[model samples]
Target: MAEGICCEFLKGLQKIKIAEELISLGKIACDIIIISLISQFKSIISMLFLGHLGDIELAGGSLSAGVANITGYSIVKGLAMGMEPICSQAYGAQELTVFRKIYKKTLRLVLVACFLISLLWLNIEPVFLLLGQNQAIISVAKVYITYSIPELIAQAYLNPLRIFMRTQNITKPLTISVTCAMIFHFPISYILAVYFNLGVRGVALASACNTVITILGSLTHLYLSRTAVRPWDRQAIDMRLEDWKPLLSLMVPSVFSVCLEWWWYEIMILLCGQLSDPQASVSAMGILMQTTALLYVFPFSLNQGLSTLVGQALGAEQPARAQRTAIMGIGVATVCGLLCFAFTIVVKNVWGKLYTGELEVLALTSAALPIVGICELGNSPQTASCGILTGSARPRIGACINFVSFYLVGLPVAVFMAFRLDMGFLGFWYGLAAAQASCACMMICIVVWTDWNHQAERARGLTQTTEEQASLLS
Candidate 1:
């Protein structure tokens, strides 16, 4: 009878533990979404400002932003993600020194990368011309790209800093920092773009200023916050070429994985530019993309939070816990996706008016948004699986799957539907929906078949190496 009572107590304790974990995940996911939404709104504000200027500014801004995102921002962000597993696992192992070293090195690498990307941006005009973009919009795009330089530089620092804090489960500071920056974003953008009549350049500058504010705010918070981890060491900030091997191993695959997905979206925008009534098509897509960005924040937050959770779980030698976290992330993502679908459908016909009063653009956006909403259905689970891959330190698998799905399967369907079938801009979205569904299906299978214990062991090895390396360096 006493043994039976003890078992009952144990079961109750287990239930409480599960409840606690669910609550913790919910809190982290909420914090991350709040911060992400604020950050995304900065860009949306820019788009809104530019869209109000005219279709030329809207098309040009969207095109330029798409190019910048695909060629520069996505790459930098992907490389920074290489630090996710490292920092999360190191924090889990309580190896602050290793975490600091990886963070510092990643910052340096991305700075150099940003420099190279800026060079490309500097001479982006000729490249756009070569791509056969509308010449009128191309010239406008040049001005927008030029002003975006400072933001690019700021992002190089901001991405790593954000990841560093995220790994340590310190999210409220990021939320506060981004919120402060977001508060400044709209007023600053309004002054420069509308009040001063600076046009797209003003919008770009406002975005840069907002990013700078976010970076500074985050840094200040990190310095003041007394987390379990100690302050970052000044001595640990140097770049070590030997360390590049491990980071690059992850970074290269990560770059391809993220870039492949982002680049496909950009390519879709470019394809829209090639359609009849190019300006209207591009503007409609720009508005739709902005709307989609809002829905994306939740799933992306899950990706970040779950990646850290799974990484930490694996680092702590809890394979089952890591697997459970991945499953929970997918479940949460699915629910978010369904909710977004309903919201998107409800707002599709009206949201375009928020960007522009152009009847054609609004009509096109209304029709296209529902399709984008359909894509979201697949996007949530696919993105969740991506987070699992990141945490498992198997980014190559994600990269390979992305290439096969987007390049091999998705792109052809988009081209065929848009051009051959003469579905025009709508065809591109249909292809996008198909691609997302296929990618999600593939990723779900992989996650289910993943060897959780092996993933945990891999995380163990990664953290263990840092210990040995620190001993040697010391």
Candidate 2:
């Protein structure tokens, strides 16, 4: 009888732990969505501002932004991707020294990359050539992006800053950070874009201003952290090429994984530019991409939160707990997918007015959005799986999965359907749906296959030489 009673108590304790985990994931999901939407809402409005200037303005802005983003991802984020996992582990291990050094090096690298990219964009002529723009459109996009430079500098450093805090399960700061930045961004964008007749350039400047504000806010918060690994820990890092092994290993895969995935979307925009009546499809797609990004934002937030949580759990040597956390996060993400799916079904056409005056583009984008929504349902799960892998510190596995799923299968199938099949943009989007569904299945399979508990045990004992982990890693 005593043994039976003890078993009942143990079961009840497990039930409570599961409930607590579910609650935490739900809160993190909501927090991520709110902050992501607020910041992205600024860009969505910028797309509208450019769209009003004429489709050329919209297309130019979208095109340049896409190019710049992909380029930045490849160089900056890719190099910095190793920071999150290492930081997550250090943060969990309570090793302030390694955490501080890694970030100091990363932030320096990020700032340098930002300066170089800003110089490249401001020069304007080469950018125009690279984008294949005629003189007039190039001049406009140059103004827009040049004004947006400070923001990119600020944005470029964001991964390291956010990832550092994320390692400790700190998520509230991003919401506050974006909120403060927008306070400066929107009003300035309004003043420059509308009040001063600065046109696209004004919108660009406002975005830069937002970045400055965000970086300042984030830095201030870091200054206040209990961890001494805050922004000022420069002395902790050796700052030599030889000392970079720990950070670089993790960052390389991270940068590739996200860049490759987002590049596929940007390429879709470039391809639309080649279509006959390029204005209709490109404008429609630009609007649809902005609209769909709002939905994607929620998933991104959940993914980031999960990545941090999983990393910490693994750091703490609790594999089963990490599994439980990942499962709960995915479940919450699915519920979000259902709501987004409903929104697409119900409000598909409502947002097009925010972008274009053309009735035809508006109608076309509405039809395409529902399709994008379908893909998003699958995207949410796949993204969470990505977080699970990252948290497991297995970015290469995620990287391999992304390469096969997106490049090998997703893009090829999408291109075939979009042009060869003559489905136009709709075919492209439908192909994405098929690809996302397949990828989600693969990710789910990977999650089950990975031995998280064993990984947690290994991750706990950071005694292995960096070369040793490299050998074991995929």
Candidate 3:
């Protein structure tokens, strides 16, 4: 009877522990989702301001922004993600020195990359001219890109800082900083665009100003917070070329993984222009893409939170905890996927109305929403598994899986169905659904098969001091 009672108590304790994990994950995910929404809102505000300027300004700004995302922002963001494992693991291991070195290294790498990308931004006019773009559009794009250089530089600092804080579970400061910056964005944008009449140039400047404000706010918070890592700590200043190899190894694959997926969406947009009813199809596609992006915030938030939790667990030498976290994250992501599926189906008919009044666009969007829903079912888990892989320091696997699923499998299916099968716009979405499903399946399999104990050992190596690693190697 005593033994039976003890077993019951242990089970109850385990249940409480599971509940605690869920609460922690939910809190972190909520903060991340809020941050993402605010960032999206800022972009919307910038676009709205651009639209007020003129049709030319709006079109040019949109075009420039897309190009910048594909070439500049995506790469920087991907590179910055390399810091996740290092920072999170080091923080968990209580190795503050390694964490600081990785942060500085990542920041420097991003800045160098931005400098190179800015050169490309500067020469966009010539490139667009070469591609036979309209002279007027090229002129506007030139101005928009030129003035957006400051924003690029700001991202270089902001991305690293975000990762640095997030790994340590210091999310409130980030949320507060971004919120304060967003509040200032509207007035700053108005004064620069309307009051000064700088037009698109002013709008770009305002965006940069707000981003700088966010960076400053984050730094100030870090400085003041006793629990947070000191951004200005002098002891964490050591750097060496040899120390950079591990970061680069992770960063390059991460770039490919991110860019491949991002570029695929852009490619789909290009494909829409080739459809028979290009105008309606492109418009509908745009609306559906926006819907997908908005819904994606939930899964992506889980992705971020899971990566941090798993990394911390492994770094602290708790393989079982890491495995459990991965499982819980996948389960949560599955629920999110189901919710997204229901949402798309329920809103299918009226969703397009929010974006357009055209009957043709509305009809196309309604038909496509179901397939997009199916894609989300796959995307949520696939994304969560990506976090698992990232936390385990195996981003190359994700990159390879993405390439095969999207380009090799999905692309051919899309072309055959759309052009040859005469399915048109719907065919494109069906192809995406196929890719997402396959990707998710493969990712989940890999995650389930992961050697958590091995990953814990790897984390130890990653967070080790140079001498410690060298001794181990020898």
RMSD of candidate 1 to true structure, Å: 3.6
Weakest ten-residue segment in model 1 by summed lDDT: 465-474
Order the numbered candidates by lDDT, best leading.
3, 1, 2
Which digits, one per residue and each the tens of the lDDT, describe model 3 over residues 1-474? 999999999999878978888988988899999999999899999999999999989988988988889989999999999888888888888898888888988988999999999999998887667646687878898999889999999999999999899998988888999999999999999999999989999999998998999899999988878888875556554567566678887899999999999999988888988989999988998899889989999999999999899999988999988998999999999999999999999999999999889999999999999899999999999999999888877888999999999999888888889999999999999889989999999999999999899889888988886654433223
Q: Which stretches of candidate 1 lie over 4 Å from their true place?
A: 1-11, 48-60, 133-140, 190-202, 228-231, 236-241, 274-280, 348-367, 466-474
- Give one digit per residue, the lDDT tens place, for model 2 in 286-373: 7777777777888887887788777777777778888888888788778888888888888776878876789879878888888888
Once all C-alphas are superposed, what RMSD does model 3 give against the true structure? 1.8
Candidate 2 whole-model C-alpha lDDT, 0 to 1: 0.76
lDDT to native, each model: 0.84, 0.76, 0.89
For candidate 3, give the lDDT of residue 224: 79
Candidate 2 lDDT trough over 10 residues, lowest sum: 462-471
Clashes of each: 0, 4, 0
- Write model 1 residue lDDT over 268-329, tens digit each, in one string: 87788789889999889877877777788888878888888888888788888888788878
TM of each candidate vs. truth: 0.88, 0.89, 0.97
Best by lDDT: 3
